[model samples]
Target: MRCEEGPLSEVYDRLRAEIVDGTLAPGAALVETTLAERYGTSRTPVREALRRLQQDGLVERADRGMRVRTRSPEEILEIYEARIALEATAAAGAAQRRSDFDLVRISRAQKTMTATPASDPAAMAESNRAVHEAIWAASHNGTIVDLLTRLNNHLTRYPWTTLSMPGRWEEAIVEHAEIIDAIEKRDSDRAYELAREHMTKARELRLRIYGDDATA
Candidate 1:
């Protein structure tokens, strides 16, 4: 994929990254004038960036103004349902089609994830993206990969990782290994089953962690 470019693009990319990484948070007021000043630019680019973000589902119209989108538990769960469907199918395809090159990339990402402690949500989230993206790439389906990329970006806007829950890191490590093993052995059914189960577990853990925030 072509990486985004230029100053305006940089501003947009950084803002979007901060939103996902929680520097800019849900319901946080985003003033184009203020952001333009902060980024040493005019409000025009900031305005455009916010428009782009809104289109991408990271920003939303609010009574106060445009703000980072806050999602309900139901909405979040629905997003995960879509993700599970896409990724499970991708994983199944990956199992049947992954090349040695794909395995190498997947292994590296899996190792990085395992090496990170569960207490470190940031590191785990990054590695988690890598592992999942590798599987998506392995599937060799451009449309599904593009859709999943957009979905995952929106998913990361939530502030915490399911891995930070007690014992969740260990569980993820085991689960990821099983999925990778299934692909290695060309077991598409097992890969699909494992991937679907993985997403279901993630959605449950996230809802548990969100607690009152989920409902509110």
Candidate 2:
């Protein structure tokens, strides 16, 4: 079958989507020739895409060859801890620095997420990313924003199917609303606390759904 739009760009997008959606599970081997055939392209573009994934920490060169990076349970916990630190700091900064326009944007995104049906996991995930990215941008720290963007590449490996579980989407909406409320009030400490709490809870829920194997 022919690939979607954007030849080179589609190579990257397709591979990234597969990795993020868990089609290429963590620790799965990624043979260059197989990928090239699958995508109807030469190995050149496949190699380039793999390199980009490596730089993003989603893939790594292992003893066998290039494979999706696997995270141990301990490693997952560590990444979540780091997320707590970085996200809390970002939320604090955002609360202190966000403009009215930024607040409006965040509110709009939150509203969209809330209005989305619980059955629409893909839309929810995309909207969730947008809200978080808006907060990161409001912080006005390019360094932290860049770092978090990279970190999310790794985080995307985990299945977000948990968010679609019964009642979980509602819980997520409530959690996100609390976060937006804190940001709107400009309570930096509350905002930081809420952001950290939200991530911690998400990590726990994810672990519960997929067991230890889901982490990487």
Per-model tally of clashing residue pairs: 0, 0
Winning model by lDDT: 1
Tens-digit lDDT track for model 2 on 109-195? Answer: 888888887777788788888888888988889988988898787777765555776788888789888877787788999989999
Model 2 accuracy (lDDT, Cα): 0.82
Over 1-216, each residue of candidate 1 has an lDDT whose tens digit, in order, gives 222232678789989988887788688999977887777777777888999998788999988779989867887788888999998999999998999999999999999988887767789888888899999999999999999988876776777788878788898889999999999999999999999999999989878877856557
Residue 166 displacement in candidate 1 (angstroms): 0.9
What is the Cα-based TM-score of model 1?
0.88
Error of 2 at 132 (Å): 1.3
Error of 1 at 61 (Å): 2.8
Residue pairs of candidate 1 with colliding backbone atoms: none
Query: Which residues of candidate 1, in runs, are more than 4 Å off?
Result: 1-6, 21-23, 63-65, 212-216
lDDT of 1: 0.87
